[model samples]
Target: MARALDVKRLSLVRLALTSAVIVLALGGGRALAAEPERPASQPQPTPPVPAITRECQTPAGVKTAPIPLPNTLRALQQRKKIRILAIGGASTARSGPDRGGFQEVFERIIEGAIKGLDVEIVNRGVSGELVRDAKERLKVEVALTQPDMVLWQVGTSDALARVPAQEFETHVGDMVRWLRAHKVDVVLVGIQYTRSLAHDPSYQAIRRAVRRVAQREGVLRVGRYEATEALERVRQGRQPTPPDPFATTEGSYACVAQYLAQAVTLGLFARRVEPRRQRPPNPAPAPAPEMAPTPPRPLPLPPKGG
Candidate 1:
């Protein structure tokens, strides 16, 4: 009976030792897992940023950089002087009884607008000429001047001559293309309405066609038709019958001439008054007094333990 009791006690002791070993192993595994997780939760240090450098250098013996020339200044230096050549058809070529032709009025207006710039204006107007006729004489009338810009006022006689829209477009397009190829800028003038065709379907059609061609070709267009219509309204109120082109009266050809001159001049003036770009000023240098060294600060007190 004593030997049975000793064997049972030994079995209980062995079970207790096995359970202790299992608890120690589980606790040690948990500590190892927690150590790895703690490191993951901590933040990493940030890298240092690089400094930016400037390309342009400061002037010699000076801290501040010299101011750069403005775009407008640079552009002005490179700009070619503009020379304009005015070419008119029919009415534009005529100096009404008041001696104010489209050319004269336009020239005066443009001249007034460009103050310091060199500008030259020329007038080559011919009465009773069609597009075909103008094209034939273009070399002598326009190309000879070697103008930088050409103000072409045609299509009135062409419309009156019953020229087909296609043919008229062809002539104008060819003329413009040729001028552009030679580096000449162009502005197209639309046909003005006369008393005969003021309300005519064909007149409206002609004006529409000209407007489309001007837009498609990227040419500047003058609204001569609208101007004439306005003038007609004013004249109708003042006169019994529309004054003849050759007649000199208050509401006659003289008035029309004055209007044409003003319109053309204003148009040219507007083109000359375009805004220009300016450059930024250089930053001022630091003052000599500001560059002096700062005074030293008082030192902090030692910690209690130290």
Candidate 2:
């Protein structure tokens, strides 16, 4: 019986050894099949926002022309308030988001650009209006709002309407001069630039007319065309510009707002500002005539006595 028990024990121990070997083999296969151990990877750094992605993100390379926002600057200095009247054609009318449009974006940008100045922009954009219509409305609106500055978005409508370029120039010049005479500064926002219209004679002519008017008046015209074209190139991976430069995208409008804001801020702060006008000195009183009165009285009395 003892010898049988010993044989059974040896069999049981062999069975256990075989099971352990199978387990070890299976585990080794799994380890060999599994992926090898690797060094822990470092976290990837976040990429920067590209200039083309957002207008506000990039340095605008702002061209500092002499804007001389005289009244606007003066009011900002004294009253801490500056009001702007935005008058224009289609671009100004529907050139932004569905709710508030580009004017709203412009107001927020201006306010954000210049600290400690209350900037109010009133939108008086009438889509499809020519320079004549804009001028007429400007008169009434100026009388009502009495804004310190007039952001005149011109040229596009005149070009589209086939108005004579000279006539367009005349109308724009007249209004800018009128605004200046009325102590209001003018910022002429030229026509929206489109690659499609670059070759169009009428559009180019009107653009030239607007530029001439701005130059003649010595007012600031935001470089809407050039700046936007540059931005479009940057956005399109430096490819040839898109045919419709002003594709009416929210991003396009935002870029416009940024450019306009930069222009206004530079005009207000960077330019040589006009000092507050001093009152003229009072005129000197006229001198009294010298007295030969005593001698004359004596002569008259002697004649009466004789």
- All candidates: TM-score: 0.53, 0.65
lDDT of 2 by residue, 63-163 (tens): 63756677887788788788988887554434223545566777776775556557788888777889887777789999999999998878888888889
Local lDDT at 17 for model 1: 91
Off by over 4 Å in 1: 1-81, 91-100, 243-306
User: Local distance difference test, per candidate?
Assistant: 0.57, 0.74
Best candidate (score: TM-score): 2
Q: Candidate 1: which pairs clash? A: none
* Candidate 1 backbone overlaps, count: 0
In model 2, the Cα lDDT at residue 250 comes to 67
Model 2 TM-score is 0.65
Candidate 1 worst ten-residue window by lDDT: 56-65
| Candidate 1 vs. true structure, TM-score | 0.53
